[model samples]
Target: MPAKSEAQQMAAGAALAAKRGEKKVSELEGASKQMYESMDEKELEKMASTSQKDKPTHNRKS
Candidate 1:
């Protein structure tokens, strides 16, 4: 199979982060909720990149 293009990967990552953020807002108890709610895609992508840098990789992981 072909690999995901950078744009596709970034978009998918941002979408996943946003969904996670929404769940976080409902699940977190305090300031963390507000923090996630306030983050835009650019910030979310940065956060996701930093958070995933050292993680293991696989086709299904992303």
Candidate 2:
């Protein structure tokens, strides 16, 4: 599924990089760290690939 916000998309990209060994997993923090641990490469890829054009910086809880 696509990410709900820009931050989520960015986190997914960070997590994806770690998963691919382009970045160290230890370097991830916050949502990026959690996603690196819980999501597979494919899942992270999907979320990370989402366009940020219309997404908000943060998704507000309603």
The candidate that wins on lDDT is 2
lDDT of 2 by residue, 1-62 (tens): 99999999999999999999999988999999999999999999999999999899999999
Candidate 2 global Cα RMSD:
0.6
Instruction: Please give the lDDT score at residue 30 for candidate 1.
Output: 42
Question: Local error of candidate 2 at 6, Å?
Answer: 0.4
Q: On residues 1-62, what C-alpha lDDT tens digit does candidate 1 reach at each position? A: 12234433343454445456544334443433443566565655564454434333433443
Candidate 1 global TM-score? 0.33
| Candidate 2 ranges with C-alpha deviation above 4 Å | none
